[model samples]
Target: MAEWTIGGVLDAIAGVIPDRLMTVCGQRRSTFADTADRSRRLANFLAGRGLGAHRERHTLANWECGQDRVALIMRNDLYPDAVIGCLKARTVPVNVNFHYTPREVNELLEYVKPSAVIYHRSLGAKFADVLPPDALWISVDDGGVLPELPSAVRLADALVEGAVDQRISPSPDDVVMMCTGGTTGRPKGVLWRQCDTYTVSMNGADHAYAAEIAEKVRHAGPPWFAVSPLMHAAGMWTAFAGVLGGQTVVLYDNRETFDPKAVWATVEREKVGLMTMVGDAYAGPLIDELQRNSYDLSSLFAVATGGAATNPRHQQALLEMLPGITLVNGYGSSETGNVGFGRSQRGDTRDTFELRDGALVLAADYSRFLHPGEQEIGWVARAGRIPLGYFDDPDATRSTFPEVDGKRVVISGDRGALAEDGTLRLFGRDSLVVNTGGEKVFVEEVEEVVRAHPGIADALVVGRPSERWGEEVVALIARAEVRAAVTHDVLHTHCAAHLAGFKVPKEFIVVEQVRRLGNGKADYRWAKSAVLREVTPA
Candidate 1:
């Protein structure tokens, strides 16, 4: 088989790798055997409920009929069995952001109108008002809350009794949808596939890294512990890469409420050899904790950072703190897999590019094949095994995967260029999306919320400098009244009504007037610089 369905992959792995220890969260250790057993039992439990293929096709259509896309609003449990279960039923998971507040959660439910939602019991209340009274809701009791929804099934019991059905296989064209695009609102789902997952591991850059790490894992314990949630692209790709290589993946269940101290303790206790992070938000806290405690971290083989740009200052500090440690700075995105080929030793070099068509070219920061006299910056494009299309959205699929002279190539929105020797230099995302920590917040979306405030006429939400969070959101509001003074506190409270926690501005800056082009277009460069000076101390 080119690639088995999500279920078949697990089943095959279980048969071949029965003795291996799979996932570790604190003291609870789940072996490959345990995971497979639980998954099978879970399948049986659902079968017992008359929810399997035994039901007539038309009757089954009553719930899933006309449903092209669905969301799996669930938390990370012992193993990601729900991801397998949903895929078995030919339903791609939306993987809704777990940090979404009740209001935001409700809005997404309205938008997707999923036939069914498999959520945690604690999250049941979050969906109470959002979901239709009769909409089918199955709360996976993660040993936390007792689910009393109309259609309730305690996961432990449900999994055991669900009947077994014909194993379904997913094709390469089938999607493993996660994050949303659209930049406007109600995020659109990004697509991936079983083949893509396997391909990411087998990809040139990733393959070399995995082989190097596997050798290290043979001599040492687990090579890495994923500090961030596996929901995001960086975290998910890194974690999955570890999984494909049979390296132990150590992750905390409570990444939603990040605790710097707990992370340190876990590192010390778990003997984490590699600590992978993407941006300055995680690096700042790690550096702070390293300073506070004189703990022995000799087991920590290296520190890898990617997903966002890291400042030279931050990179220098981290190297000084963890001398003799491998500090790798890499780059990639959800649409285009792992494009950044060069790895930074001290993390000083923010320059990134990928080997495309067997040559390293500019990713998004510089122009491709620069002319002798033409020195202007070029928008980056990676020419390689980028995805064919996005899930369900043909327009976006076309925008990213463009046709040049009838040849299709994926051009992610980020800008960059190639050097003479083909070393790729990547600029940060040029799409006007603010990556606060690891989460993406589109400026256009945030500006709409700021404009909703009665105190504002027009607004620009630009990323401001921050030592803690990689990028702090700053709203530069255009005021209508000459005497009105809009304070940061007032705007924060205003956002509590309409925006999610992550999207809300940490600090609000009042401007005499919002700078824009003659046609009311946002001048991002002007807004970015102005907000930086306004928020950052001199």
Candidate 2:
């Protein structure tokens, strides 16, 4: 029989691998049996508090639906339990970025209109004022003094108040809502069915080997670590992929910020075989740390990254630091999961990815698909194993998830060219493309050149309104050192050597730092503002 729901798959794996390690954090460890029991207890507790699948339309907001939504407003450590419980209870898990401001948090909560909220006690004060009165609040203690909130009940207390054996079988169509548009704009919930998400994003087991997942785990060495924040889909998908493969998940517990030393320490101690990060934003620091100190990273065989751009320079730096280690740059989004994988190796194109069978380069018109060997630029699209749609936004659902040639596809606004050899050379997001003097320049391409500079820490490329050209390309840079020997002429010379003159930045603005989202994606909105602020007269 096909395993329809995520909880069912987890249970099947746990039943076989009962004593296998499931999760490991700073001081917390859980076996498969322990994970199952805790999730069951939490599921029962949530059910008792009137949290279960409700498929009626919500009366509160026009852009709201009646899926039993459980918002998670905590750090990465509590994600596995909350996500598992939500799945087992037949409820949708909505990821809430705890880093958002109170206003942003309020906006997301209002839009999602969740039936329950599982949050860290540290954040209760930040979001307590905006929570829905009808929503059940379960607070997880972070071993810190938490502000008293009248609406919250301790998670430990709730776990003991409910039955440990309560089980509810969910259909394959049950929703698992993941919020996209991180750290910018109002968050939109991407609705994905449990089974589709599992097969497409998570590494689901074949039916023949489903019952033997434990034996596979018993033979495999080392755990998988997700270095990215779990609130984002990439990290959550990494954790799920590890669990589905019957491998233990080693979660980083540093809630403050990205600490490369601590991460290396954890990897060395746990013998993490595979680790996931988010592009060059993470790779740069990890490479710098390797240069500073050495660790027993022999157990680590592969490192994977997604959700942002990873330039070839960063890949080369990593390979230089750790020879023979595989570096994978994954191309994907919340709507289109696992579109393609780019193995960063010697002589590989910097930003190019090998297209998976289901991945396609659709014509800019979206009328037909562009075949391989077509030199025309097209939107990168994917068919088969895509999301259901954006929750509560049927219009957006129709626009993004369109049916082409009698087949459904999801186009997440990424633009790329299909090469003669069938490899896809990603140009970057069409929305962020800068057109200067009738010539199109991809910011990501230019940014890659800028970031490749040894003296530059980070860079953001934006278009500034110009009298001569329609829109001139401007670069905002963050220096690697306090007094680095980097200048406008030096950068221009570097970029000119690699790219066409029009694609080079006309002006460079030096800043203390470049803004990035928690998930390591470029804050284009912030970059645009910074460009305007610098170019405008005082």
Query: For model 1, what is the alpha-carbon lDDT of residue 230?
Result: 65
TM-score of 2: 0.79
Residues 223-342, candidate 1: write the lDDT tens digits: 468777766667766765665455567776652477778777887887888887767878887778878887767788777776776666788887788776767776667666666545
Error of 1 at 523 (Å): 2.6
Each candidate structure's TM-score, on Cα atoms with residue i matched to residue i, is: 0.84, 0.79
User: What TM-score would candidate 1 get against the native?
Assistant: 0.84
Residue 471 lDDT in candidate 2: 66
lDDT, each prediction: 0.62, 0.79
Candidate 2 residue-wise lDDT, 138-232, digit = tens: 89887668675796888888889766555565677777898865222346799887888888888764354554555655555589998887888
